[model samples]
Target: MTGETAPVAARDEADPVAVIEVQAAVLTRNFELLRRRSGFDSQLDRAGYLLLLALDSLGPSDIGTLAAALGLDPSTVGRQVAAAEGKGLVTRNPDPQDRRRSVVTASPDGLARMAELSVARQRRTTKMLAGWSVEDLAQLARMFTRYNEEVAHHYFTGIDQVGCAAPHDQPKHSTAEDDS
Candidate 1:
């Protein structure tokens, strides 16, 4: 680890909140780097990329569904979808079940572009974590998955009622080092 990251790692072992804060900062920096390195920033903005990902993961969906899933306003999603459609990245079809609603899906070209971007991201991530052992990578993956699951559960369970919970307050688990 670099002199900069060593302090953060030391703090992470003692303070879960510190770890979370550092993780957030790292994610923000990584996202900016990825946006610059990948050509997606030139072709699509953050909202567009998120919309495409939602469509890819959730299949064809209506504007309202996409908006809710993405935590974006419906009008915002509508405009993004329109822009993507114009760029031939997405297609709109009348919902068979409801003629009044139109569902959006990625076009063949969009899928191909998304696939290319995915590969680029994977390659970049692999290179960035090149020194990490397999066990370390697996631990990171598990930790991220667990964190996301907890946040999702809290979010979907009525954020007004439950509010956000601190990571350390949730539960305790064996450290990655303990797994060895």
Candidate 2:
């Protein structure tokens, strides 16, 4: 980041792939900082946000199912679910089929909170890209989605609909580790 960066929407034709990687790493750290300093006192933390998001998309599910969807360990998901439940953001009820297991679901209150958090984040992002055109914003979103998919492909095994390997099946190229 010492020298002049490439123009917006432009790639540096001269830099090697390693240089791009380094820049990407810096960009992620910078984005994290931006999120932290955005002056929004978000009620939902990252774990809770992600958990609700997964539950919203997947419907009510057992902790193990939610954990798999979120790419988190069940223990970690359990702790998060507990915290959210304490906040009235989520609930865990006895699974109908299996009386011993609890199924976690995002409460209506949780979804409302999540929506507010999402709007706040989106506002911050819109402010940051104030001058960007709609087409540019779309392109940026597409590129980021592509990059995220590639990252998940290499690091996670249980991503659905991407033809990724199942939990017990490991792809040769993926040395699975929870880098997050």
**Cα lDDT tens digits for candidate 2, 1-180:** 876556333255467775666678779877787668764436788788888888887889888887777666789989999999999999999999999999898999999988898898998789989999999999998887777556555655455432222454343363346343
Root-mean-square deviation (CA) per prediction? 9.1, 5.1
lDDT of 1 by residue, 36-96 (tens): 8777777666666677877877789999878766655689889999999998999999999
lDDT of each: 0.72, 0.76
For TM-score, the strongest prediction is 2
Residue 40 error, candidate 2, Å: 4.4
TM-score of every candidate relative to the true structure: 0.70, 0.78
Evaluated with lDDT, which candidate comes out highest?
Answer: 2
